[model samples]
Target: MDDGAERIFAALRDVSQSGAPLYLQLKKNIEEAVKRGLIGPGDALPSERDIAAQADISRVTVRKAVQDLVKSGVLVQRHGSGTFVAPRMERVEQSLSRLTSFTEDMARRGMAARSQWLDRGIYTASPDEMMVLGLSASELVSRLSRLRIADETPLAIERATISASVLPDPHEVTSSLYMALGKTGHRPVRAVQRISAVNLGEAEAQLLAVPIGSACLQIERISYLASGKVIEFTKSIYRGDAYDFVAELRLPGPDGQEGEAT
Candidate 1:
């Protein structure tokens, strides 16, 4: 065994005597190694058989321990490749009550945000887009699709649609769509968003560098101007492991007290 594997085996040996279940003990040992930077992210783990033989434990114990870590996002398994530690990802906490662009939010967190444009052009509004944006079938809409990145890490995919009259040219939007709309004096003042959990498809998983069928957050948003006109309709998919949506809640007050819900 190499020095790294030797160190891991030594750590495993130290935990084998603990009263905890063998699998739990093994899991804890691996976690401790990661915490101490003995095994950094993306480091390949020993094969189950090799680990079991060296640790004097059953292969089942190692498998169970590894599977647990995979579910907890500490490890990842590739179909053709061996299991490895998951890449460290920054978990962004987003406030559901606020209307902020992805660029603005990342800027507030001191992270550089950028977008890779997938498609941007004027297109006929689809039936769903027409319904959501309150557009007619004949209306042309500026469609913008992009892969959002923060600090060079892929974070989400966003597709937005707005009336052509509101956004005359989609190509003019080099970065934040909201910023582009601001120049037209049509930036949305408020937006309604619905969030749902989904299993990402193959394409989405590949784009996000995650395993197929990974859990993701699907969000649909309709933004309105001060005049209550639907200004934008957007659909986005975010990596579940990298984002947390937070909302403040308050209990009911006394009678005649007004409380706002966000």
Candidate 2:
């Protein structure tokens, strides 16, 4: 064990005196070491055998602590490789005052953005989609579902729907949906969006590479054209730890009146 590892295990002395469980005490010590920068991201952790031998604790205790850390996004365990501290997640700030596409937003922030298409096709409109898009039962809706990535990090899962009349071919939307809509003269001028807190399910967790039940933001949006026609409906799931929605606020003037935030 390195000196840093020794420092991390030093707190194990008199574990019986600590009110917490032995594994919990060891967990706390490991967290403290991480906070103090004694162990950095991607730094390999000593094996369970080594840790048990050095800390004078059972391997079961060490395993429990490490598993907890992994679930908390503190540590990562590769199949054949040993455990290591997870790399830091970069948080992104998005302006709520502006309606922007993920590609445009990332471009504004100077981060490379890309998408992996999940599902794209013209399908019979579902009841919810028909209601949201103002389509009749006879009409179809183009559906586009994709994983949005920024700087190679999976940031969100976006699924959008549009009336086939407005967007006949989902294939036209290669990158930015707005750009594709603009070409068809159906781009939206404004939108109404609602955001809610949600927990990731099994499939969503796997796609996002985070623990199940991880907190995330769920957003539903309706985009309108200049003529007040609903042109698009979109739902998105964003990683809570990697994004912050910022809305600029101002105090009312002497008249107790406030203008639009923008």
Candidate 3:
């Protein structure tokens, strides 16, 4: 076992006065180790069998403890890989007043940005996509799904759909979908976003490195061109704890009316 694992075992063995469940005790001990820098972020953890054998605890207990930590955002588990400390993330504020791509938004904040391609293909438009992007049943739509990251932190999952006539090849989108659409002279000049508060589902939580049922912001956007033709329909999920959506407000000067609130 590595020194970190040895420290974790020592910490667990030293807890003699606690009345908490074994899993809970181990959970707190492991969390303290993380806080004390015994296990640094991105450091792979020892296997469950190793921890259980060395700590003299049941593997079930170890699993439960690790699961709790994973849900609490203290640890992250990659498929086919051991669990590791979760990466630290700085909270970000985004303006809702302007239309911009994820690349543009992250660049403005001076954060290096990148995307993990989850999907890029041409497929038959779904019913919702048909209505949102004004597509026909027989018409195909280009799909672009990506995990948007800024400064090595996964911030959002963006999935966009556009008519094949407008975007025949989803793979053409390199960084920004808006930029790719601009090449075809079909970029949207305006967009409408519907934002809602929700809990993260299992798939989304895993992708965003948050616990299942963690707070999230679900946004659906429809984009339109200057000619009033719909061009894009996109859905995005953002980590609520790491993002704050801000919009400027104004009151009408000449009439009893309110300004736009995104």
- Local accuracy by lDDT, each model: 0.87, 0.85, 0.86
146 in model 1: Cα distance from truth in Å? 0.7
Q: Alpha-carbon error at 75 in model 3, in Å?
A: 0.6
Note each model's CA RMSD in angstroms: 7.1, 5.3, 3.6
Q: Write the per-residue lDDT of candidate 2 for residues 1-262, one digit (tens) a residue.
A: 5775665556444345358887888778777778888787777788898788777889999899888877667777767888887777899998888888899999998989999899999999999999988888999999999999887567899999999998888998999999999887998999998999999997887566578899999999999999999999999999999999998897676688986543
Predicted model with the maximum lDDT: 1
- Arrange candidates, best lDDT first: 1, 3, 2
Clashes found in each candidate (C-alpha, N, C closer than 3 A)? 0, 0, 0
Top model by TM-score, which number?
Answer: 3
Clashes by residue pair, model 3? none
Q: Against the correct fold, how does model 2 do in TM-score?
A: 0.70
Instruction: Please identify which of the two predictions, 2 or 3, would achieve the higher lDDT against the true structure.
Output: 3
Residue pairs in collision within model 1: none
lDDT of 3 by residue, 148-241 (tens): 9887678999999889888877888899888888887888999999999999999988888788999999999998899998888999999998
In angstroms, give how far residue 195 of model 3 lies from its true place.
Answer: 0.8
Error of 3 at 218 (Å): 1.0
